[model samples]
Target: MAMAAEEIEALITGGIPDARVEITDLAGDGDHYAARVVAESFRGMPRIKQHQAVYAALGGRMGGVLHALQLTTAVPE
Candidate 1:
């Protein structure tokens, strides 16, 4: 099953309360997505850790129902 953009954003925001999340359907198939996430909590985190935080927010749905995601994360400046 493909995950919706709203679902993705909800999951991310649910975990990272102060996140500013923007989700895009890269392939228009609902399975592939691109996300840009900005949060104050990511300030001191490494890029890998930042990506991991977003992935963790999805609650283990990344490779299963969610499929592909090209994710970018940054701290609010």
Candidate 2:
């Protein structure tokens, strides 16, 4: 089943309490998505690690229920 944007946001925010997450449906198909997550907890982490954190937040949904996530993560300045 395809994932909804609200579900994606809920997963991310659930994992990262302090995260500010924005999820977009790239194809409007509920399968393709883009997420921009900014969190204070991400400070001092590398870009790859930041992305990893977000992926981790998804709890292994990347290729399953949630597919094709173009993720961008950043720390609060």
- Residues 1-77 of candidate 1 have per-residue lDDT tens digits of 89999999999999999999999999999999999999999998999999999989999999999999999999888
Report every candidate's CA lDDT. 0.95, 0.92
lDDT tens per residue, model 2, 1-77: 99999999999999999999998899989999999999999998999988888889899999999879998898888
> Please, what is the TM-score per model?
0.97, 0.95
Candidate 2 Cα errors over 4 Å, as ranges = none
How many residue pairs clash in model 1? 0
Q: Per-residue lDDT for 15 in model 2?
A: 91
Error in Å for residue 55 of model 1? 0.9
lDDT of 2: 0.92
Summed over model 2, clashes come to 0
For model 1, the local distance difference test gives: 0.95
